[model samples]
Target: MKSRMHKGVSLILGLGTACTIGLSSLEPASALPWQQLIFNGVQLLQLSNISPQQTVALGQNIHQQVKQNYRLDSNSKTNAYVNRVGQRLAKASNCSQIPFRFYVVRDSSINAFATTGGYVYVHTGLLNAVDNEDQLASVIGHEIAHICNNDLINKLKQTQLAQGAASLAGLDQSAVTAIAYQLAVDLPNSREAEFNADDKGLQYMRRAGYNPKAMPAFLRKLVRQSSAPSFLSSHPATQERISVIERKIANGR
Candidate 1:
């Protein structure tokens, strides 16, 4: 019994480290061959209470590293546009108490990603992909949902617990931060996380007065391509995602 319990705990603890390092699934369950469960079960370990201040400080660390690798979009107009859209969605998010910040990357890839401390990055390519503001809001809303859902904090806590609680040993602060940086800039979240983001993002879209269907519409356009777009490289988006999201829209949840 003791050995069995320890094995279960270890698996859950490992998810935090795996999520942080940007190391995750490649086995798709259904329509998407790329999707897989990072953990053995659906349960995410929320073992610790990470205060907003701790997350903000860690987020700053992660963001500093992000700026070093990617060039920020220099266009004042583009900067304002993405931030403007992101800010509006933040108000409708579950974690509205803290400020949300958005940045635009100069790269022309259809990608957007978020990190702790309410920071989200949008690619110029993604901006060009959407037909209107509502589409952009839905994307940003999804990112906001990631941050607001305590997904970031959960990763950090998992990393800590996997190492040890009392000694403050293991990966050390800098190593963990480095892993988290990669997670923000270049990784696919677990399938469960992706689904939650889809669900909550729609709610935020409706609350913020953006067309709720815009998310599914935008997504359907992507899947129609002869090949998956660059956006799917970082996200686990699949046909299953679209079907589930559409159902949510119908139910108005």
Candidate 2:
């Protein structure tokens, strides 16, 4: 398949892992192709050069790093609410077949971010910033759009771990940390990726029954906030994002 990797997704989140023995050792049934495998009752995919099993393994490994560094919010009610909203948007997304997972970080920063393998993190401050669930959906949807479009995977392809790093086998931890840091704190999405995620995320929220205006509204709010969240610092300019999203909404996208 032709790669559709784009530049409209935010690259912010923790990703690391040292375990891949389990995933790499599994052998597909004789009746099935090597690219297809059933694990823990989930069907894996092999989109582009990365297999779905590798994707999940990569996600789990990074999740371990995130767990080590961040306190995951355990408020069942709050976490459940975020997951519910996320699932709704996932169902409306183009890559709905991918099992999307959402988690809440205990940090007070008004931000949300995603990494490869359908993992998305929403900060506690972000939960407090949104006026309603629709706005929250917009944020989550944008992150999901990034994963669906394989934006981060493309980023990995350009990094030192460019060759089969998704397998998480024999990968250098220090290198992974460096790449993750660059993604989270240094690398901003290309202007095209920002616009594409905004447009796709807006559509996702709206298709999932949210007000289409919520996306741009939330972006505008971020732009005007006295203490703009780190999210703005790492994404395309908020004003430019707002303009593009508003134009798309006005044009009936």
Candidate 3:
């Protein structure tokens, strides 16, 4: 019993770390350096325990939490526009076999995130920031890649044993809620994950008939701003990512 409790605590702490990195809107002027965050993420990745069924269940829980915690914009036209672009990219993605859903959070903070299963979220701030449909598609495509690749499931696999143990013990739903909130809103992806999303998303966009260069163009815009939005701050774009995307674009990939 003591050992299980310890494992549960450790799982929560790991999720806490994810939440802190994710809430860039509340970030201090001197946020933890990117190197440290990446190192910490790599450590968290060491724990995998979730399965396909669990992944879906976990994603549904997080999606509900997001809707409850965040105010969703109710404009039908805006929602339709986002869904249209998201559907296009989803159809073009290799993971198109899975159903995808997208929603616009009412917040003005420029950001986007994806959770387990095929859930993708876009912030109203992000929609307002982009210049055109292609740029919008770029961002949506990135989130879709995260789902398609099962990145969250891969990460949660690290905590498989702990989560299973907790469930068997019938831990309170609040604990799951807390962890789901962090996963949905606080955890940031690793550098490799970010790049992978970018690459896959770019492919999806191109296949969907959008200009691939729109990705780098949007990313470049995000990196250049003196005060980076939550997306750039949380994702922390690096020169390497930009360079890789540029190279891919130049090579006509």
Candidate 4:
């Protein structure tokens, strides 16, 4: 009877030890860090963990596409002027570690866009429309804020994960991909992001020795221009944004 009791106790001890070891092994490896679990049990990529090399490659790819599709002036004077202003604003941005390159598109459209890879493109019409360096800096600062916030990547990944969830729910891969692509391309930022960008852009302009109020002034001009049935009609010039900018300027002091 004593022997049997001892045997049973040993067996229990051994099983407990084995279970503990198994659980330890089941834990995910530290090297392959787990990301935030989202819908459909899909994990989103941690943007901070993303490699710089990958970002550069992505930016370069987008830059090539923009170059191919848009009409950019190759003139040295225009390029130099744009680069000078961009460099100044980029230095004041939160993501100054990333190298920034600016280009002036020859198109007359009043459009400006920033890509994930630290590339900022400004249309000739935008430059022509601005009155001074402060106005230009405000535009650049706003665009740089988008880059600093990693808004593009976040939107892209959010879209991909959403589609992935749909795919797991019996949606075809092609359909999911199509939807994801469209969402990624047309990801309008949230109101919070827009306001944050406006505030940050104001600070950036101030840091670069330009008047922060220039942002609100330029925005007002854009809002007025939007009403004229021009190419600038497609932009976000809602009164809310104007009000936000005005409030920031009012409280900034």
> Best candidate, TM-score-wise?
1
Each model's lDDT: 0.71, 0.68, 0.70, 0.61
lDDT of 4 by residue, 1-253 (tens): 0111212333322332232111111123222222222335433333434545555555665565555467788989888988898899989888888888898989775666676658788888888988898888888888788778765655544443333333333333232222222222233554565667777888888788888877777777767763542323434555676777778778863
lDDT of 1 by residue, 152-185 (tens): 6656554654444332323334445566675555
Give the best candidate by lDDT.
1
> Which structure is stronger by lDDT: 1 or 3?
1
User: How well is each residue in 38-140 modelled by candidate 3, as lDDT tens digits?
Assistant: 2321222222333344456657767777776788889999999999999999999998877687888898888888887678889999998998999999999
Angstrom error at residue 162, model 3: 8.4
Cα lDDT of candidate 1 equals 0.71
Of 2 and 4, which scores higher on TM-score?
2
Ranking by TM-score: 1, 3, 2, 4
TM-score per candidate: 0.78, 0.75, 0.76, 0.71
Question: Per-residue lDDT for 141 in model 3?
Answer: 94
TM-score of 1: 0.78
Give residue 244's lDDT in candidate 2 (0 to 100). Answer: 80
Clashes of each: 1, 5, 9, 0
- Model 3 CA deviation exceeding 4 Å by range: 1-11, 15-54, 161-174
lDDT of 4 at 103: 88
Q: Model 3, poorest ten-residue lDDT window?
A: 19-28
* Candidates by lDDT, descending order: 1, 3, 2, 4
